[model samples]
Target: MIEFTNWDILRNLLLAARWTIALSLTAFIGGTIVGLLLTAMRLSGRRPLQWLVRGYVELFQGTPLLMQLFLVFFGLSLLGFDISAWAAAAFALTFFTSAFLTEIWRGCIDTLPRGQWEASRCLGLNFKQTLSRVILPQAVRVALAPTVGFSVQVVKGTALASIIGFVELTKAGTMLNNATFEPFKIFAMVALIYFALCYPLSLASQRLEKKFNGSR
Candidate 1:
């Protein structure tokens, strides 16, 4: 029944929050790039490319993220990669984020008016030009809210990284709880910290969605 002091627990949580921030940003950025590639492939006219992209999306989305992390951490080690937990966690999260994002963005893209594509083609735009200049620009407005909202999920998902020994906020909380025997205090503070990180992003996403919808 050790008592937990506010300042001590807050400082430790903040330090752990740094790793959470790092991992979240890493996964989001990496996954965004990969997701864009996946989106393009899914939209591509090639049958094989579409199938491949679909398979990739389904595989990651269908599997539990915990299992994916285990596969990356333990499975990769078995394959002789010698990867650290940090790398493994990041890799696993990137793929997990990419699959979800691709699906999200595909929905956005699909929401565009079919006339937009027809009009772009009428202007002599190739597939690449049509997507880059016409479809994507409109789709982006539709995509922004969900994309920002998903960022909160990315931040929260860093907790799973703790299981793989990534030393993020949850891991730090666990360590502190173990030392001080104050699980309630440690976890409450951790939840508060996560709320602080995620709430603003959620608000911003809502605002953006409202503004964009109004503009439309």
Candidate 2:
């Protein structure tokens, strides 16, 4: 067994943590974009579009994320597409993120008073104009706290990417444990690193919720 110095183990884990951060950010941003589109479709007042969006959301939200990652990684190969682990992880996580975010944002939008929509329509604002100028602004404020909170979930979910051979923090921890035969030490450090990344977001989410509630 190769003995890894404390510093060596930490440095490697820290380097791997960068990939975790990158994957989380990529998934969040891509998911946000897709989620917005899904939200628009749901709100479009067309039954077909709404049904499509609803089904899409349900399909992803109902399934296990680990399974989604597995499908993205291996299913692509079976279809004669060669994809990297990074791509597979990002693809799966983006859809997973989008599904949850769509529901979160939808709840925020639904929280708006019915009178707000009526008032906008009475003012001759079209659907797009009213949504852009009036409804979305308020919804965004309501959505911000929970969105930040859900981001912690996204960060944690990146750990599953390790199953697909993506060498993020969890993967690096596994590799170091194998080399150093110190699963407890390696995993504890991994947990600490994840906490360091996620705790502030949790605190901020709580603070935002409190602030928003107080303002109401």
User: Largest lDDT belongs to which candidate?
Assistant: 2
- Give the per-residue lDDT of model 1 (tens digit) for 73-168: 999999999999899989999999999999999999988889998988888999999988888888999999999999998899889989988899
- Whole-model lDDT per candidate: 0.92, 0.96
Backbone clashes in model 2, listed as residue pairs:
none
Residue 35 deviation, candidate 2, in Å?
0.6
Deviation of model 1 at 204, angstroms: 0.8
lDDT by residue for model 2 over 1-216, one digit each (tens)?
777899999999999999999999999999999999999899889999999989989999999999999999999999999999999999999999999999999999999999999999999999999889999989998999999999999999999999999999999999999888888999999999999999999999999998887464
Off by over 4 Å in 2: 214-216
What TM-score against the true fold does each predicted structure earn? 0.96, 0.98
Q: Give the TM-score comparing model 1 with the true structure, all chains together.
A: 0.96
Give the least accurate 10-residue stretch of model 2, judged by summed lDDT. Answer: 207-216
Clashes of 2: 0
How does model 2 fare in lDDT? 0.96
